[model samples]
Target: MKSELRDLYQEVVIDHSKNPRNFRKPEGANRSAEGINPLCGDEITVHLKLAGDVIQDIGFQGAGCAISKASASMMTAALKNKTKAEAESLFERVHSMLTEGPKSSVNPEELGKLAALSGVWEFPVRVKCASLAWHTLRSALAGSGAPVSTE
Candidate 1:
């Protein structure tokens, strides 16, 4: 069952990487930010439309590895319609799950599809790949309009 679950998650990652969701600029996004991982040359732009404290819409565009692209795609899908606070909480949780090592106690189920990326911890280097989009999303939410770099 564990292997089956791994296979399922791998398929999810590959599917999203090949055919990303919300992978375009929205009609009128109020927040936008870009993130780059220089080591692997992965780049991502996060676009968000917030209505008051609620995120009405979110999307992304960029060139990256399967892990990065899939992470961005899944993140957008999970965060749409969430309030600013909710999204931030998710960011903290997902960031922890990604960076913390396999010994982490973070419950992936709490993150929804974002949990598919839990396996990323296994590949220490790829942890950044899975987090680029998330960091970009946080920057966009900050309304900095500044480019983010994973250094």
Candidate 2:
């Protein structure tokens, strides 16, 4: 990442972490799942209202590290009105980015604000923090009752 882009991404991460979007349990949310990262004590619940496979609305409620919260916030924003397949594809992309570090094939520019998390791959432990919400979102979309855990 270029110096300026890194700085900008950092700023985006900080801003989202400080004031996460969709940080609530939205009304009429028909699907929900909980996630936890016991290593870092990050916990969250993702909620979604699907209208025939399209995400009609999305929200989350939780207390966690900046990365976790921001990821959830950005995820909700990115996923609203998207189909389940789209969300899952996005998750795969983001998951790859998180695990692959800067060498990941996915383009940061393509992720929009979510590209801010590009740097997180450098920190191994923080990856779990950042991914907790995403895994939970998958669980919610799958309508799974089991709680998610990053162990």
Q: Which candidate achieves the best lDDT against the true structure?
A: 2
Candidate 2, residues 63-93, lDDT tens digits: the string is 9977888888899999999999999999999
* Cα lDDT, all candidates: 0.87, 0.88
TM-score of each: 0.92, 0.93
The CA lDDT at 68 in model 2 is 87
Best by TM-score: 2
Clashes of each: 0, 0
Q: Which stretches of candidate 1 lie over 4 Å from their true place?
A: 1-9
Q: Between which residue pairs do clashes occur in model 2? A: none
lDDT of 2 at 95: 98
Candidate 1: tens digits of C-alpha lDDT, residues 26-145:
878988999999998888999999899999999998899988999999999998899999999988889888888456677887777777888888777788888899889989999988
lDDT of 1: 0.87
CA error at residue 45 for candidate 1, angstroms: 0.6
Give the TM-score (vs. native) of candidate 1. 0.92
